[model samples]
Target: MEYRVLLAESDRSMLERLCQVVDDTPNFTLAAKFQNVSDALGQGAVFNPNLILLDIEQPGGMGLVDAFKKVYPAASILCMGDKWQAESASGSIKAGAKGYIIKPFSGVELQESVDAFSRLGSDGSAEILVFFSPKGKSGKTTLIANLAMSLARKSGEPVGIIDADLQFGDMAVFFNLAAQTTIVEAVRDIRFLSPASLSSYYMPVAPNVSVLCGTRTPNMIDKVAIDKLENLIAMSRGLFRYILIDVPAGFNPTSIAAAEASNTTFLVSMINGAYEIDHMKRALHIFRDWEDMENRAKVIFTRVEPCDAQARLELSQKLGYPVTEIIPNDYAIVSDAADKGKMATDIRPDSPLSRQVDRLADNIIGRKHRIRWAGV
Candidate 1:
């Protein structure tokens, strides 16, 4: 469809440049230009444009998108600014702006931005989930890596994983990916990034799964601030249907921030010794201070030797917190898959581990699932 563009900007030079770009681009006609948004909205109807290119760098400009929308219900209002800001983009989008773009951008860039915001699904925001463990080597990363693929396949929507373990993250290594951009860069650039633009930081690994890799080195953790990481995750809600975060073992600023942001956090552990139960009790005691700890913080024991309903019930009684899920040990295939940089489910579909992972995925999506094995 051809676009009749109405331009509104306070800067004359920028206005002229915008007019020129609109004039030169195909299927985009320069309908009218105004130095003030009030004049533009008051006299906008005479031109009858379908697209309103608004310069949002001006004071109170982002706030006026809804006013313009009320005036011209048919036109698409695209916000442009001197620099990108997450708050401004979120505010404008909430106020009915189609999308945001930075100044000195091309007609192609303008089109893509508008197209992206217009394509946002109306299914509400993403469901954020986090994986937390008392210590590392509890199979947290393995579960999350496989879950990304499972959720994407079952839900038929995009799935994203954030490796919040800045000091010792191995998400890229798990996927065998040489990520060009990591969470560190994303945080550094988040001040100038909008939801649509933030997609560049994530590397697509599977059909519908993508990952924001962690910091490149252990020391780089200092570069990733907690507040910035939260902003990164908040802006990313518009880009994916489900976001799974992997926090470093034990409690820290990063891990706490991730868990607090999530709708639910799985407190994962491995079946090693009786001391593991004591560790969980200590952790759960800390979680008791948080609201809704029982429902929001779930417990899962991996590599369970006896993964049965009876075993799960007995373990739940022992821990006080119900066992949400228990994954049986499938070491041989898992080792081989890890060696080859493949998911256990992908390589061994019939394996007990694969079946349990799929069932876990089922539980996550609120789908009714049944356990196949009667007894362990």
Candidate 2:
């Protein structure tokens, strides 16, 4: 499908250069170009381009971000300016740009940004998947790492995995990413969060797969409120095709908030552990009480050994929840991939375990002919 783009820059020469580059790109057409933010805002509603390339610093020193957002809320805006002007970049994001490309960037960079925005239009709502377990060592991080890559690979779309486990999250370790930025920093400036600012906090782990690692300090958890978390997830729905949130164990405020914000909550557990069963029951009880959560909860049994069929049956019967998918106890493959900081989907795409992950992705994206596990 052809994409219509609106390029808005006060600099006439730069606008011409960007137009030329957009013309050369495949499946993209420049619907309009404006030398001032006012002109862009005046025509935005009528033109209604699918994507917008906006300049933060324009004539009259007016906040172009605010004006354009007021006019066109659906168009994905790409903020352009000097990278050092972080405040302006942040402001533009707060005003509702989907992504941002710094000034002096290559033509390739502009083309890629446009392409990402174009893909967003195809996926109606960005699919967000949150992975949470009752406690640590339940393979939540491992599952998320593999699942993020698998979803991206299978669907050929952008996928984001967030380590919402505020304290003691190991998502970065599992992916070999340095924990430089955390959701803590992003939430601190929650007022400025939009697609562009959200994109700035992400660390790309693989092609079309990015991660938002959790904060290291427990105190940082208090910095992120439920509303901020919900807003972040809501804004993310515009940029990503799939989002996997790696939630912390136990029913704390953050975990509860994450569960509420997610479209589907995969209550993960393991077989042969009475504590796991008890935790699952407690989670169910909590979900049952919350009037808003009854429809969005599903039980996913992880690390199930073939010999533990009886235990699995008892657990499923007791909880009255269908065991959506039983991930086999394959520590060798899971642990090796985790230790090496490589995704299992990348290492063993043809393996039984990999096939299971693929199936899980299909279920999450609503591609398979199975019953809807959650209302969403």
lDDT measured at residue 192 in model 2 versus the true structure, 0 to 100: 52
299-358, model 2: which lDDT tens digit per residue?
Answer: 777777662447457657877766666677778888788777797778878766777777
Give the Å shift of residue 94 in candidate 1. Answer: 5.2
Q: Clash pairs of candidate 1?
A: none
Model 2: CA > 4 A from native? 1-116, 289-295, 307-314, 367-376
- Scored by CA lDDT, what does every candidate get? 0.82, 0.72
Q: Which candidate has the top score in lDDT?
A: 1
TM-score of 2: 0.69
